[model samples]
Target: MTAVALLLTALFLAPTGALAADKIVIGVPTSLNFLEGKEANNSVKLAVDEINKAGGVKVGGKMLPFVVESIDIRDAAPGVPVPEALLGIEKLILEKKPNALVVGPFRSEALLAGMDMLAKHKVPLLGTIAMSPKTEAKVASDPKYKYVFRVSLDAKYFVGYIAGVMGFLGKEFGFNKVFIMNQDVAWARATAGIMTKIFEGKLKWKVVGHETFPTGASDFAPALMKAKMAGAQVIMPVFDMPQSGILVKQWKAMKVPALMAGFISPLTGPGAWKTFDGKIGGALNAIFELGNIPSAKYPPSKKYYDAYQAKYGVPLEAGHGPAPSYASVYLLKAAIEKAGSLDPDAIVAALKATDAQGVMGHIKFSKGNQLIYGNDPQKEALGCFFQWTDDGKRLIVYPPAIAEGTIKLPAGMKAAK
Candidate 1:
């Protein structure tokens, strides 16, 4: 192994039990059982190492390096209660007293409840997951919640992007009828609802059926059958859990004719086709970071894509975990430097004024303490809608300016008549 690789491996694998002097502890309180959790931790560690090597953030006349301290909130998988996640974050904060946080609770319920603790403790956090619109409301309504920021796109923004793609499909294949399937969770349901309103109101598409499935529920046949029976042309599924694997496998096996699109965390990466045993073909996934499905229209995506592969020895996966969490770290660093101290409120102010290029593209915080997104890769942090081919290839087919190919249906499936 090269010297750089050895050094990175040491830092990544290093124990967080002890803290060195003049180091800023970046706490990661997320569910370790999920892919997003693991990737979030990995990406945060990678970014901290990169920043430390480059003469760490200067604050209060001292160079403060970054160290990662994480706790397993265990909410991404089923069975963990929201209260338990609340306690986990509380413990991570009281014990570690990290200068800042990243990749917080994986579920919206925990995030809503955890927001109180974060505000009470006055620890600034940059969350990459848990996209509930309520999060924005909380930040907007209360000044105490100003310490919290979502680096990843929220559900509303996600729905906006998906709605446009669905509209394009309506024009492309004459699709009209739609089916909405979402995990019984706040984030998924919100995304599904927002898309439904847009489809029915602005897009003039017919809504065939809308169903909510329990989290961790593996049987998707019932919904697929209903969608087919309703003569739906598009299947919009919002799932953040790993059950997406089951959903796609069932979709392919059952030969569902509708175009599957929306947010499926499991199918967000370049390796998704292989991950689901090549069953995800023809499914269009809405990614949180453009890098999740890497496009040539953006150079930063390529840089982050290659660096992740080199550091982790695998393609980046686990929803929008890696890239967003990686970017969040640099954001926190920049905020700290801009504030020139470890004061939480000052960091929050710096973050609000942030306008830096991330792993995807340009990033700036608009209203609601969320990153702004636009169609132009050169302008804002942009994401795309991509479809998978049968032989495991990802095609960037949306936002015409950055599109590499047109959306295609799975072989043997015909477009809506």
Candidate 2:
């Protein structure tokens, strides 16, 4: 074949630019090695597929499909050095050259380290897993970091939701004494500390005890027993690891009289009903601003929830990760279409002006704050406080406006003795 003919053939087959199957690339630089990172990435992919099927995004008067360029960064797995993830971010930004980045880094350390990199390249990032409020503070203080947006649960939001539930329990059941137990991690510790302040200062409740345990630790007996002995009427457990399954089992086997509430990761989703063998019944769990269980409660969340379930044959991870990551993809599409161009600065401006409904509810990013707006579903992505019913259903039990069930004494609890 002639050289000119071969070159023309290659150009026709290539799926870039405005020729054949053109696409807008979204960079997902995260720890792909673990569940949270993996699921979050999957959610991003799911959104991409949905958008592509819906005729993609219109840009430059042509519809372009969305695609993802995800880097392992060792999958943002825990204990991985921030520098390692930072290098992956650089590679993804410079090499992959995505139009926008979602699910940027799994670790807060990595997120903080990569901020300058995202800004240097002017690639907007929607971080869906880093919980550090410092990220928000950084965005608020510096103009250089304005390209970053946080869709993850800030510690304040998690602790605030748990505390809000505790407040509800206090008024509903005449409960007062509270205890705090946290899995030894920066996010958990920070949240627990905030819980202490809120429990003591605002609620005027007695904090009978405070404890911390390392991640992957088994046998929460010591902490559970301590609460029982301290006359703790309620115990708030701050955990995100899988081993929290052990904590739930111990809470039931020991028959502790106190109501177990807080962000017990294992008990937050529908699977927990079986994973804990119904022991999680009546336990209060915090499902980050995204809706709980089926991940399809709210119309927006339901869309992704159904897509994921249909594609992967499972429900969404009701954790701090996937929901927002999924929503961020749609948010990116909205911003891109709103900007009517692929320019980074224009997209960031449109993102700041977002008022679309997302997984939990309406999503509106704060101008400089860079966090999702408000604590109510009407104004923002309100986190849900849910209880697992004995019949194996998750019922919203807080935020009276959305409450599907009232606060009831946890099923596994014994009468205060």
Best by TM-score: 2
Clashes of each: 0, 5
User: How accurate locally, in lDDT, is each candidate?
Assistant: 0.83, 0.78
Query: Cα miss at 59, model 1 (Å)?
Result: 1.9
Distance from true position, residue 306, model 1, in Å? 1.5
Tell how far residue 203 is off in model 1, in angstroms. 0.9
Alpha-carbon error at 79 in model 1, in Å?
Answer: 3.5
| Model 2, total clashes | 5
Against the true structure, whose lDDT is highest?
1
Instruction: Kindly report which residue stretches of model 2 are placed more than 4 angstroms away from their true locations once superposed.
Output: 1-21, 292-297, 373-375, 411-417
Candidate 2 lDDT, 1-417, residue by residue in tens: 999999999888864333433678899988787777888899899889989999999887789999899998873465678887788888988887788888777677778888888888888898887777888888888989989998876766776777778887777777789888889987888888877888889988899999889888988899899999999999888887888878877887888888888888777667777787777776778777664334333566666667778888888655667878888888999888898788788888899988767776778776554556345666777777777776878877777757776766754454432
User: Which regions in candidate 1 have their CA more than 4 angstroms from the true location?
Assistant: 1-21, 216-226, 241-243, 253-255, 412-417
TM-score per candidate, chains pooled: 0.87, 0.90
Q: 112-157 in candidate 1: lDDT tens per residue?
A: 9888889889898899888777888889888889988988877767
Estimate the overall C-alpha local distance difference test score of candidate 1: 0.83
